[model samples]
Target chain A: MVKSRRTKAGDIGIAAICLLLMIICLLPMLNVLARSLSSSQAIIRNEVLLWPKGWNLEAYKFVLTDSKYTWSLAWTAILTVICTFVSMVMTTLCAYPLIYRDLKGRRLFNTLILFTMYFNAGTIPHYLLYKDLGLLNHPLVLIIPNSLSVFYMIIMRTFFYSIPDSLRESAEIDGAGPIRILFSIYLPLSKPVLATLSLFYAVGRWNGFSDALMYMNNRTYHPIQLLLYNILNAITSIEIQTQEGFASAPGLSDTIQAATVMFATVPILLVYPWLQKYFISGATLGALKD
Target chain B: MKRSSAINRKRIANYLRKYWTLYLMLSIPLAYFVVFRYIPMTYVQIAFKKYSIVKSPWEMPWADNNGFEYFIKAFRNLDFLYALRNTLLLNFLDLVLGFPAPIILALLLNELPFPRFKRLTQSVAYLPHFLSWIIIAGLAKQLFAPTNGMINIALNRLGFESVPFLNDPVHWVFTYVFLGIWRNVGWNTIIYLAALTNINPELYEASAIDGANRWQNIRYITLPGLRPTIITLLILALGQILSSEFDRPFALTNPLVNSVSQVISIFVYRYGIRGLQFSLTTAVGLFQSLICVIFLMAANALAKRFGERGIW
Candidate 1:
């Protein structure tokens, strides 16, 4: 009875600690949400705390109705989908040929790929190359240049190496080609890895702003993150110039920024829970071998 | 003999034919690397000449080789050095403070008994990792505002003087480091937690049976278990010492705090993009990459000597 009581007490203590930690992690985001929804007067009064003083959705309405935001969202979505597909295909195909243990010069190919992680042609030369190739302002510029990530390729190759040799041997005996075996046998077993890597590539493409800033001279081609960045910069400059304080337009102050952040964050956050299980597994599978 | 040689040739051809589709699939990626990665490497020579967009890189308009002209110029520029110093100093602070927070958090999380709550806390902690630097920085500015900011209001409520958080140069590094920890600590903790999961449970059971306390168990067992991961990640971070630009400082920088904010990448951007000194920009970039490569190699060698599995 005493031991049971002790265990119960321990459980309660752990539960309390966990709850506190979760709040700490989540408070900033919740604060942002609260500020976004509060009335301008309430924001000025600084009365808004855990909940908005007087709720309003004007910020959301403004951000959503804005053509820049909408166009950038469309741009981000297209880029994410196309980049994810290309990255996955490149990784899988490059990994497949290198996975064959008996392949001559496999070590050389592996080393060459790994070398890219440590050294690169630097940024300007890359820009010049894109300029020379007439890839500047082309949407494919974003997709093609960064299509093959050596880290992802290495992970895929490691996964392919783990597949039992007998599966390939049996398939070969049945007159199956390498491509057929890859499609029929290897790919099905690689679902977890595929999902994890796809999420990685998608998130990267969605969040990518530097490429848009550098390559895309036109404002229309900017991704959603870039748009948000510009808005944030504008807000900062406004605050710097006025010194009038956030209370002047309290309704617009907290909530709009918060809403914009949430809008940028929500899509990736929504996908994470669905792919959470695979993320850890994929990370382990990739890291454990080497 | 001729027949045997022909058969040998036929076998080689058959092998090539069998794997042709696989090679075909790999062609696009190979071409991408050649055109985007390898070919651009040739343009690094433009750093030695006065390069113009009108004339190709091979056509040098200037007679001077300019052996170290750009490097000397970049070194002499006080703004460049100030930026370099600020970058190194901030990175050092991040290494000192930011590196350990995740390990400690992971350790604390590991000790907690409730699984559901633990998982929930972890998810919440990692949410900020997905936020773009712009959003995070904006949030920071709002939260740390001198008058209307939540932090200052709380401090005033507690009867303390409100601090100038963002504008003050003295406070800039602190804000940068604090935000860095807030944004990245959870994501990094996840890696450590993953490492912890791989540790055998029996070792903990054995330590418990020996009457070891929780702290001792962590010090003796958990810390040792995390050594390889810590080392590997440290080496990776060291390799990125010259490359951490565009995210934290970029978002935090303003004219007020520009002294402490400009990093090597920002420097490159200023010279390359805004100034349009393409050759000088490329030279600076090449110098940064070379430094990173040397650091990575040295770290890898050190890891090998210490008997840890290095990136190599």
Candidate 2:
């Protein structure tokens, strides 16, 4: 009887913490949304918090109308699609063949592939190689170099390994070749894992900034994240200029920064429901670390 | 013997012919790994050679001081030292503050009775993890900006001083760590939560029968079940002690916070890529990588000595 009452107290305490976490997670983003919608007068006067004050859509209008911003958005969307398709094909190819237990040089291939996951040659050599390959300032630098993720490939290979051997054996007994077996049996059955990995690949490509930061000098080819990074860096310099009092860039307003963040963030945020649904299994699979 | 050799040849031929397509399929990814990944490893010797436009780094003579010039330079350079100090300091703080946040959250979450609220809390928390650091930086500027910043403004209205969250170096480090925790804590709980489900309900029932309180149940059953997962993750995380994701420091840092924010990756970007100081930067990179591997091995060995399953 005493224990039950104690348990109820514990439960309430836990619920309160969860509620606090939800608010912590929710409030700042709502603040960004509020700042983005509020008038510059109210924003400067420090009126906005969780809700808008003197609300307007001028920042969104400015961002949507700007060619540089809109072009990168569209360009990144296209890049995401291309990267996802190419990466899926590349990853599937890398993973499917390795599941053959009796394949020649399997151990060697596995060792070689897995080594890349742990030890990258670090950034200098990677950059130098990209420079030598004539990919510097080229957009293919992003797509080609990061084409195969050994981690994701391992996830796929493990998934492939889990499909029963008897399934493959029956396909082989029917005189289906390895390719036929992979397509008709393995590929068809592996849609959920494939979709999950594809979503990850797409989202990763969409958010990627570092490669472009390092490998390219071309501003026009910058993706949305890179664009935002440049904008953020530019604003820091402005903040230094105005640090004594207030930051007031001519075109880059507080509302505009908030709106830009929303634009960059919303696509991935829109994918959250699907990510919430898919990621638990994906997380568990990746967590296996096999 | 000749007839047996002929039969073996036929068997080899059949094996090769049957699985030829698989090998063909493997070649593309293998080629990518070779060209993009492995070949660069050999070029790490550039750290030892002199930079030249007319000759490759390999063709250039060994650098000053018998090939230890750049390593010494990196250690001695004030900016590099600052970066090293900041990297270790920031990551250590993250290790202290950021590491256990998820485990604690997961434990608290396990005690929560409402399934719907638990799911909603998790979904909301995980949302921030998916957003890019650039987006997070924007959010930070919005809330933490002085004077007009929402949080600072709120504080002022409440008769408190504005916090220099982004402007000051010491506060910057803590803010950076907090942002990191905010981004990762919820998402990280997924691993611990998954581990929690693997613990047997029978243990909980037995503990309850023995009159073990909730704290005691967790102390005995849940934590013990999570030990291997925790240790494995810790060992893996140690490998990344020197090499963090280049994105966060690169994105979240500003000129004011540069002293604290200039990590090794930023060092490499500034000197190697931008300054074209290939020898010095590659030495730093190699040194960073070597230390990372050492930390990883040392951590794994330590874990094994204590009879835990390390990541290996």
Candidate 3:
């Protein structure tokens, strides 16, 4: 690290800019929090700024007890878990063989996977294919179709490459097969990268709702993100109405939407702090190597 | 030659037996690619075919016999052109403006004297990146709503008219671009900060010794250090010039701004999924994929020409 004088003009300037940007970044999110906690009337009146004008959990109560929100949340949680598990397994399996220098057809497999990054069959065909495969409207639609992200596979592969050859060789010498060696040795040694990838997969699967939107026609099958999206639409659509009741009721809609947004967001946010350090390092190193 | 070929075949068989488990592990991914990736590629031919939902994709008549019809139709469609233009324009705007944001943020963050403050700020900045476009869109709608949005409220407080951030076409694009930067700039900085850490400190020391001021040192040393990374990312960004992102656009777009916001991906969704016009939309999707491939190849070539790492 380069040593620098304290309180230099450059330092002050950089810190100030960073701080200002941070506030800009944080303010909207914080405002949502404040709005969610504030009374519906305060929200509609635009009385709440960064602080709650009237504190209440009525909106939160609505979100938690609502059947639509709860069902979608359950689907999203299950989908995230299954998708992450399948993705991690496939990524590991795909990345492992490619690490071996003597693995036949390694270049062919790598090229096949890499080709996908630049080109695809596009959305329509993928949708049609999924439809044909009986994946449409099914929970597996979210999991199987996107199970192997080539980018994450490459990240994991790079991590596997950094592992010493001697470990694998020794394991093999003791009669460990590739599967055995991978299970007993490689997976044990790859905790940080695995955790990083698990978080990536989990977060990605959790936030992703396009699949649900496209594939599932049943509102009951909608994921939490899609539910939140619909809820937001309700909030925005409320703007078009000029009815006297709605005019008086705009605040409740704001608080309800804000509460739903937080309900969808806070669970994922809770997971972030646990894996953030690994996520940072993983992202940085992965991008550099890429 | 015949005898050597037999021996080579036998050697291959022996090698397969020894590492059969590895191949077994790989077979799953290979099968996955074939089923999910390659099969969809075959379906792309439907773009050229007289596609019928009732018929299997393979049963559709090929384009050369009469298939360029949809392609011609797509070209003639004014909406398609608009979508293409909007896609290219939005992506280009992002490339020009949004691309440099993270690099600048990373550089500024690097200049901070206190590590603790820097780390805290970085974490806060990265927070938005984790949010889904759905949540971001919700937050954006709340913040920019014409009547009661926080920004509008502030404007009204200052005795100004509420800006139609979501309704107005031009202002919508501005909001789209700003939101894109807001959500991603911090996350994008991680790579650049990593690149910053890789720069040799001694070079900076040498520059300081030569009486180079901070700006001069940054210009000559830091900028040069970041050149490869900047070029690599720019090349990657160029490849995505046609891919006006689906999530952000889809979530944020309103019926009022559909003219400006109806991008290629959205067009695909409209025609393919909702309109149920498989052939027309597939043609559009194929056209997009072709352009994307061309862009990727061109970018990779440029990177290679500059002696930087090509993505391939």
For each candidate, the DockQ is 0.51, 0.74, 0.74
Candidate 1's docking class is: medium
Query: Residue by residue across B172-264, what tens digits does model 2's lDDT show?
Result: 999999999999999898889888988999998888789998889889999999888889889888787877668887777888989899998
The Cα error of candidate 1 at residue B295, in Å, is 0.9
Query: Candidates' lDDT values, in order?
Result: 0.78, 0.85, 0.85
Model 1 agreement with the true structure over A197-278: per-residue lDDT tens digits: 8977887888778887887777777788777776666554356224312222433645667677778877877887888877
RMSD of each: 3.4, 2.8, 3.1
In candidate 2 chain B, what residue range of length 10 has the lowest lDDT sum? Answer: B49-58
TM-score of chain B of 3: 0.93
Q: How does candidate 1 score on lDDT? A: 0.78
Listed per model in order, the count of residue pairs whose N, CA or C atoms clash below 3 Å is 3, 0, 1
**Model 3, range A124-229, lDDT digits (tens) per residue?**
9999998888888887787898899898888898889899999899887798888888889899988989999998899898899888888888767778888777
> Model 2, range A118-222, lDDT digits (tens) per residue?
777889899888878899999899798998898899888888988999999998888999899999999999887898899888988998888988897787778
Candidate 3 stretches greater than 4 Å from native: A1-7, A235-251, B1-14, B63-66
